[model samples]
Target: MGLLWGLIIGGLAGWIAGNLTRGGGFGLLGNIIVGLVGGFLGGVLFRLLGLAATGMIGSLVMSVIGAVLLIFIVGKIKGRR
Candidate 1:
């Protein structure tokens, strides 16, 4: 199912993004949330930039990029609090 695949890809992308940015993951739930939101953000960003990504790997790349950006922004905001 599409939902199942989305979760799987999102989780992986989130985990990868966390690891890449902070050297670790944000647990299962956090990763899923981050990844799913990141996927949406990535899609929008790509669309705005007139970019396209096809297939699993491409999706993963976009998701990870978005996840990393999201995490960074959140970290900055939290740090200011």
Candidate 2:
């Protein structure tokens, strides 16, 4: 159940982040991967900032933010190469 929700949320988060930042989607699996990683990254960043997510929506928000940041960073890195 938890894993299922995580995947669903992750997919949604990634899709949202991708659309928001790049104006496109990463497909289903790619979105899930990005979103899971983004959620972890977001949690770490929130902790560092003394912030916390309280519920599913909060988690989604955090994931989206992290995904966007992740995408941006990756884009920059790729651009530099």
Candidate 3:
């Protein structure tokens, strides 16, 4: 159940992040991967800042923010190589 929610939220967050940042997404599987990782990153970041989010919407917001940051960073790294 948790895993299912994670995947759904992650996919949505990744898609949103990709569209917001780069004007597109990295396909279904890619989005899922990016989003899941981004969710983890977001949790860590929010904790560091003493921030908290509640419910599905809040989780989605945090995940999207993190996914965007992750995508941006990855883009920069790839551009340099």
Write down the TM-score of every candidate: 0.94, 0.97, 0.94
- Model 1 spans > 4 angstroms off: none
For each candidate, what is the lDDT? Answer: 0.92, 0.94, 0.91
Query: Candidate 3, clashing residue pairs?
Result: none
lDDT of 1 by residue, 1-81 (tens): 989988999999999999999999999988988999998889888999999989988898889988998998999999998
Cα misplacement distance, residue 28 of candidate 2 (Å): 0.2
Winning model by TM-score? 2
Worst 10 residues of 2 by lDDT: 64-73
lDDT of 1: 0.92
Better of 2 and 3 by lDDT: 2
Model 3 residue 23 CA deviation in Å: 0.6
In terms of lDDT, model 2 sits at 0.94
CA lDDT of 42 in candidate 2?
Answer: 94
What lDDT does candidate 1 reach at residue 59?
Answer: 91
Q: Ten-residue segment with the worst summed lDDT in candidate 3?
A: 36-45
Candidate 2 residue-wise lDDT at 27: 99
How far is each candidate from the true structure, as Cα RMSD in Å? Answer: 0.8, 0.5, 0.8
